[model samples]
Every structure is written in C-alpha cells, then in structure tokens.
Target: MKLLMMAACAGLTLNTAAAQEMSYGHAEYLNSCAVCHGVDGTGDGPLRDLLIRRPADLTQLSERNGGTFPYSRVFATIDGRYAVPSHGNREMPVWGRLFLEDDAKNYGPSGGEVVTTERIHNLAGYIETLQH
Candidate 1:
C-alpha cells in the first residue's frame, strides 16, 4: 500500500511537471499575446478593432525577415528591450515585468530576473513555431 502511494505521487509529480513545461509558453502567448496576435498568430485578435495600428500578423515574421526567424529581435520586443514603433510608448504590457512579478510570487524576489529571461525565451520560442 505504501509503495503504491509512492508510485502514485511520483506519477502525479511527473505529470504536473510535463504539463507546466508544455504550457508555459503557450499559456503566456494566449493570456498576454493572443489578444493582439491571435491564437493562430494572424494578428486578427478581437482587440484589433480597437487599435489604430493593426496588430502585426505574427505568422509572417520569417517572410518579413528574409525567410529567417529573428529570434533575438522577437525576444527583445517581448521583453521591452527593443521598441516597436507601432506599439507606441510600449503601451502593450511589458511581459518581462509581469513575468518577474509572477516569479516573485512563485520563487521569491531574489531570482526574478532569471525567471523573466526564461519566460521571454519561452515566449519567443513559441512565436517561432507560429512562423509560416
């Protein structure tokens, strides 16, 4: 009985870890970015109607960049390190800040920067998968 309980707990831990890792970037994109970029990364999100400048069609990032995904640029853009002219004073939420806040809640305040960077990388990598 004890062995069975231990096995069950181990299974639960593995499942939870896998789910968290798999959903990390996708969840961030959906919660923060899909409002502008759309679930399909087509930039036709519901908020598009409210914006003066249309949200960029994220699927075309590679095409717009000579058929190569600009990974660093995308990461910087998300982290607010690279300013996007159309975004206007970075009105869109700075995800780095939000991630740091979230990390502080989960992992405490000391290593928030590392958490923020990992979040940016996860988000940027997810966007790369959206490229056409």
Candidate 2:
C-alpha cells in the first residue's frame, strides 16, 4: 500500500489540478471510478444518462450490505475478477485489462500483480471511507 501511494505521488506533476487538496486514493478514484460513480459515489456521473443501467450508489455500499462495507467484494469488483454486468463480460474487462497489460509492461509479471492487488486494496479502502 505504501509503495502504491508512493507510485501515485510520483506520477503527479506540479501542473496537476488541486493536487495538494486531494488524497492519493481520492485522486485515484477521480481518475477512474468518479467518471462512472460520481465524485461522491452517488451513481450520477456524466455517463449515467448514456448507460443502459444506473451505476450503483457507492456511498450506500455499506448500508446495502447490513451496515458493513463489503471489502473483498469491492476489491474483487475493482480488480475485475468479480462479474459486474455494467462492466461487461468477465473474460475481457476492457478497462481493467488495459491497466493490467500496462502494469505488466511497467512492472513485469509478479511485480505487476502485486502492484495491481495493492491498487485494488487501496481503492477499496478509499471506497470504504466513503460509505455513509
């Protein structure tokens, strides 16, 4: 997790928008999930109107799961191992597979898997913090 946070910070540049105002996970969320889940995880991003089904209200994840954040499920969801209908076929997660491929190049096989898992864990932790 620390390694991933360092990597996230290393990728940031002085020209980035409101960099200091955002935490690493928040920045990650904005770069990825926020496009479909919204800044507050309310399922009302710009693409909401264009999709066949509404994105889940991420903030309600805990509420919907007996007041406990479904950590492993969320981790699996982000990792693309879980079958999310909106994300399309499990065999090919167009979005996440791209990241996996890129990570494989940047970090190699074992390292990339480690990095990817850490990223998923970090992102899941961030989502847990957002539960209301």
Candidate 3:
C-alpha cells in the first residue's frame, strides 16, 4: 500500500539522518581531538610529549575519575571553562563558541546558542561512545 511505503520511506530517512549526524560527530572528533588524544584515546599522540602536562588518556577517564566519566566536567574542559593554572593558559580551544561561529556562517542569522548546544551534545555523545 502507498501508506506502508510512505511509512517505510520516512523511517529510512530518519535513520539516514541519524547516521549522518553521528558520522559528522565522529569525523569532528578525529579531526580535532585525535591529534592530542590519539585515535585510540590513549594520549600517546606525537604532540603529547611536547606539552608541559601530558594529554589525559581518554580511554581510562572513567576509571581514573571515580568510575564516572563526569560528562559535565569533560564538557566544561572542552568549552575551556575549567582553568588550569599550572598550564599557564588554556590547553584546548573553546569549542562552544567556535561551533556557534561556524554554524552562524552556514545557517544564516538564526544560528545561535541552541546550535552550539546541539553541537556540544553531539560531540559529547560521540565522546561517550569512546568509553570502554
């Protein structure tokens, strides 16, 4: 029936959209975080030794931090909110604003904080998947 066919098409379309969004998050992680965190999340990247404080091995984050990944803490760090005085400056760029700026350029005037939050949530979701 046409109704059945339409329902199937809608389901497929939603699945495809989700897949694409996840792919974007994964790609963003590879391009942005892998240089410091390593593709395996082991903190063994080439640039790790050059830094004063070594990059945290992301795979062990939950174990190291009392058996919880502390999603908000991780998010804050990525957004450059947690101050690391020992490092002399922020080790990571603030991605919240960066994502917002990028979205604004692409989505006309309506792109704002909500888009940034969605981007952060997507990236966070991708990071959560990295946990073993």
lDDT of 2 by residue, 4-101 (tens): 98878867754365678677678778888887789899998887777777878999999999999999888777777546578655421344565677
RMSD of each: 5.7, 9.3, 7.1
Q: lDDT per residue, candidate 3, 53-120, as tens digits?
A: 78877777678788888788777777664466786786667887677787788875476666776667
CA RMSD (A), model 2: 9.3
Q: Rank the candidates by TM-score, best first.
A: 2, 1, 3
How do all models score by TM-score? 0.74, 0.75, 0.68
Judging by lDDT against the true structure, name the best candidate.
1
Residue pairs clashing, model 2: none
Model 3 whole-model lDDT (C-alpha atoms): 0.75
Measured by TM-score, the strongest candidate is: 2
Model 3, stretches more than 4 Å misplaced? 1-22, 81-88, 108-110
lDDT of each candidate versus the true structure: 0.85, 0.76, 0.75
- State the TM-score for model 1: 0.74
| Total clashing pairs for each candidate | 0, 0, 0
